[model samples]
Target: MKFLYILGLIVLLSFVIIYYQFNPEVYSFFPECPFHKYLHLDCPGCGSQRAIHALLHLNLQKAMGYNLLLVFSLPILALQLFCKIYSYFTKKTLLLHFWYSPNTPKIIFVIVMIFWIARNLPYPPFNYLAA
Candidate 1:
C-alpha cells in the first residue's frame, strides 16, 4: 500500500513537472471544460489546470491569476493529505481533531458555490475573478 502511494505520488509529480515545462494554456491536447463550453461561464475548476502548471513553475502570481481558489486551497489540501499519509504510515493521527466538525462540509460547499457564482459575474472586480 505504501509503495502504491509513493508510486502514485511519483507519477503525479512527473505529470506536474511535464506540465510545468509545457504550459497547459498553449496545449491543444488539454481538455476544455464542458461546463464552460456550454454555459460560457467560468466554473470553479475552470483554471485549475493552468494554476497547477504555473505553481509547478514557481510562478505564484501567475498561478493565482489563473485560479485564486486553487492557489489558496493547495496548502490546506496538502496539509490534509500529509496528515492522512502520516496516519497511514505511523498508525497515529495528526491534527484530525482540529479539522472535523458537523458543519464543515456544508460550509465548504457553500463557499465553493459562492466562488462559482462570483467568478461568473459579468461585472467589474468580480469579473476579474474569472480565468
Candidate 2:
C-alpha cells in the first residue's frame, strides 16, 4: 500500500509538472475531454486541464474562467487529502469518512449534476460556465 501510494504521488506530481510547464490549450499531447468531444457540450471537468495550468501559474481569474467548480472545490479536496494522509499514517482509518457522510455523496452528486446541466445551458449566466 505504501509503495502504491508513492507511485500514485509520483504520477500525480508528474502530471502537475506537465500542466505547469505546458499550456493545455496550445498543447496537442494533453488529453481532451471526451465528454465534450462526443456530446458537443462542456462537462463538469471539461476545462480542468486548462484550469490546472492557469492555477499553477497563479492566474485566479483565468483558472476560474476555465473551471469555477474545480477552483471552488480545491479546499475541500485538500482537506480530504489531508485526512487520508493522516489516516494512512495512523493505520486506524475510515477510508471514505472525510469526504462522505452518508448524505454527502447524494448532495455532491446533485450539485455536480446540476453544474453539468447548467454549464450546458445557452443562456446568459449559464453560457458563462462553458469552457
Candidate 3:
C-alpha cells in the first residue's frame, strides 16, 4: 500500500510539473463544462482545473478570476503541508479532525450546497464567486 501510494504521488507530481511547464490552457482540453452545457448551472468544481493551471503559472489575478475558492484553498494546503513536515521532524503527529457535530456525509453535502449557492448568488461579492 505504501509503495503504491508513493508511486502514485510520484506520477501525480510528475504530471503536475510537466503540465505547468507546458502551461496548456484547460479550455483547450475541455472547451466547455458538460454539466454547465446541459444543466445551465455551474458545478461545485466548475473552474478548478482552470484555476489550478493559472495558479501553477503564477498568474494570481487570472487564477482568482477562475475560482475565488482557490485563494483560500492554496494557502490552507500550504499551511497543512508546513505543519505536516514540522510535526514529522518534531516527533508530533497531525491527525485529521472535524469541528462539526454533524455526520460526515451530511457535513459534506452541506458544504457542497453552500458552495453551489454562494457561487450562483447574483450579489456583487457572491456573483464574483461564479465562474
Candidate 4:
C-alpha cells in the first residue's frame, strides 16, 4: 500500500511538472484570492506554482523571486518523503521529532499568522522576500 501511494505521488508530481512546463500561462482556473486582489498584497502561496515551474527549468533566481518560502520547503518535504520511504522499505518506524509538540492546530495557526504578517511588511529586503 505504501509503495503504491509513493508510486502514485511520483506519477502525480511528474504530471504536474509536465503540465506546468507545457502550459505555464494557463493556471487561471485557480481563482484569485479576494483579499490579495483587492489589497494588492501577496498571499504566502501566491507564486508557488511559478516557483515550481522555475525550479523545473533550473532557474533559481526566477524561483526565488516567485516564492522563497516554497523553494526552501522543497528540501524539508524531500527529507520527509525520504524518511517515509526508508521506513516503509526497512520496516522500522522512524521517529520525527519537533522542538514544539506535534499539535496540528497550533502549528497551522502559527504558520498562517506568520505568513500573513510577513507578507504585509514593507521593509526593503524582507518585502522582496514575499511571493
Candidate 5:
C-alpha cells in the first residue's frame, strides 16, 4: 500500500511538472471538459486545467482569467494540502478550525451552485465569469 501511494505521488508530481512546462491550450493530451463539450456550457471547473498550468508557472493573472473561482480557492486548497502532508509525515493531525460546522459542506455546495449558474449567465459581468 505504501509503495502504491509513493507511486501515485510520483505520478502526480510528474504531471505537475508537465502542467508547469506545457500550456494546456496547446496540448491535446489534456482532458476535455465533458460538461462543456456536450452542453456548450461552462461548468464550475471548465478552465481548471489551463488554470492549473498558469498557476504552476506563477502567472496569477492568466490563472485568474482562466478560472476566477479556482484562483480564489487555491489558498484554501493549499492549506488543506499542507495539513494532509503534515499529518502524513508526523502521524498526527492538526486540529484545524475549519469544517467543524455541519453546515460547511452545504454552504460550499450552495456557493458552487450559485457560481455555476452565475457564470453561465449571458450578461456583461457574468459572461466575464465564464471560462
Candidate 6:
C-alpha cells in the first residue's frame, strides 16, 4: 500500500511538473477564474495557475508576484499533506493535528475573506495585491 501510494504521488507530481513547465499562462485551455470574469474582481484564486507555473519553473519571486497568498500557504499545505501521508503509511500520527481545532477553520476562513477583499480593493498598495 505504501509503495502504491508513493508511486501514485510520484506520477501525479511528475504530470503536474510537466504541465506547469509548459506554462499555463500561455495555454488557452486553462480555465480563467469565473469570479473575475463575471464580477470583474480578483478572487482569492485569481493568479493561482500562473503562480503554479512560475513555481514549477523555480521562480519564487515570480510565483509570489502572481499570488502571494498561495506562495505563503504552500509550505503549510505541504506540511499538512506530508503529515497525512506519513500517518497513512506508518499507522501513526506525526504532526499534532492542530487543523482539527475548531478555531483553526474560523481563523483560516477570516484570513481568506480578508485576503479576498484586500486584493479586490482598488487602491495603491491594495491594487498591487491583485493579480
Q: Per-residue lDDT of 1-131 in model 1, one digit per residue for the tens?
A: 87999898999889877887888889888889999999898989999999998888899998988889999889988999999888888999687564698788898889899999999888998988899
Q: Is candidate 2 or candidate 3 better by TM-score?
A: 2
Comparing 5 and 6 by lDDT, which wins? 5
All models: lDDT? 0.88, 0.89, 0.73, 0.75, 0.88, 0.87
lDDT of 2 by residue, 7-126 (tens): 989998999999999998998998888888998999999999999999999999999998999999997887778778888999877465636588888998899999999999999999
TM-score on alpha carbons, each prediction: 0.89, 0.88, 0.68, 0.73, 0.88, 0.86
Query: What are the C-alpha RMSDs, in order, of all predicted structures?
Result: 1.6, 2.1, 3.6, 3.2, 1.8, 2.2
User: 94-130, model 4: which lDDT tens digit per residue?
Assistant: 6455523668559757876787678779997668767
lDDT for position 97 in model 6? 64
Clashes of each: 0, 0, 0, 0, 0, 0
Tens-place lDDT digits, model 3, residues 34-80: 88779877777778777877888888888887777766567857776
**TM-score leader:** 1
TM-score of 3: 0.68
Q: Using lDDT, give the best candidate's number.
A: 2
Candidate 6 lDDT over residue span 20-88, tens digit each: 667777778778899999999999989998888888889999998888899999999989888988899
Number of the candidate with higher lDDT, 2 or 6: 2
Off by over 4 Å in 2: 90-98
Kindly state the number of residue pairs that clash in model 3.
0
Error of 5 at 30 (Å): 1.1
Better of 1 and 4 by TM-score: 1
Full candidate order by TM-score, most accurate first: 1, 2, 5, 6, 4, 3
**RMSD in Å for model 5:** 1.8
- Clashing residue pairs found in predicted model 3: none
Off by over 4 Å in 4: 2-7, 23-31, 103-112
